[model samples]
Target: MIIGCKDDVLPKPASQLRLDYPVAKYASFSNHCPIEFEINEDAVIKEDKNCEFSIHYPKMKATIYLTYKTVNNDIDNLLRDAQNLTYKLHTLKADEIIELPFINKEKRVFGTFYDVTGNAATNSLFYATDSIKHFVTGSVYFYAKPNYDSILPAESYVKNDMQHLMETIKWK
Candidate 1:
């Protein structure tokens, strides 16, 4: 029998993939949608339907969908629907859901931001409302299958952009 050193045939340890993103530069975006906000310059904004929009990040293979709704005295129903979406949409795949409240009294913007962790479809979800006239909900989705560890960098960058959007929303 032959004897070898302990390190002679040791397998290499697994390594994580490295992802780098550019520094974010934001520009104000507005339209006839009755709302406006600042968005990352790298994202492409496309109007969906009604006042809805899709913010696409090609390099990250992700998109942030923004849907606009008129309060019309149904604020309760709107809030409920937005809250339900965060739970129902990612409940199966997400391991944890952390919600943070946001309020900008000066801008009359109030909302909840959800950070979804795990192998979930969305990394971030949020909703802003004037509590009387307007409501806007947004969620970021990746084209690739959800793998939290693999996409953490992209997810983080996108989430920051979403926060900026929520904080700066203005009703027109």
Candidate 2:
């Protein structure tokens, strides 16, 4: 007697779908300084030790930076202040744009995008400027840049990956 297995009988390994997503292209700006990722539609997820994780797409871009300080310290307060500032920024009129108060005093550019509004995407970006303190040791920044011309709509897969990366962030 001879036994033959079906052509598709072989079991496949668990899917590493998470890692399969497109990652941002890492670029170096200054020597021995913070790394910067070029914001683009293909930049879906990023994981790094020295720098924070950031996602950029056609219609929107989000960044989550891990501060050097621990979360138990003043990070929580800083995040709260950032959130409050975001709320106030959103209250401004559509034609008006203002600086977010929580931004570093030294940095002239506080918020990047304006015209805050809601969308159909599963994940929400800090239309203005928003941040959260991680339980582990640092804080995360979330920023969303939407396309006004409707040239390239942000893909759902990229958005989903961004959400996963944000939710999965943990200190080593």
In terms of lDDT, the best-performing candidate is 1
Model 2 alpha-carbon miss at residue 69, Å: 4.6
lDDT of 1 by residue, 70-155 (tens): 98889999999999999988899999999999999998999999999999889899999989999999999999988898899999
- What are the candidates' C-alpha RMSDs? 2.0, 15.2
Let me know the TM-score candidate 2 reaches against the reference structure: 0.35
Clash count for candidate 1 is: 0
lDDT of each: 0.94, 0.34
Residue lDDT tens for model 2, 72-146 = 556557546545544554444223333322232332112222223332112223211123323222222234343
Q: Per model, how many backbone clashes are there?
A: 0, 1
Q: Candidate 1, TM-score vs. the true structure?
A: 0.93
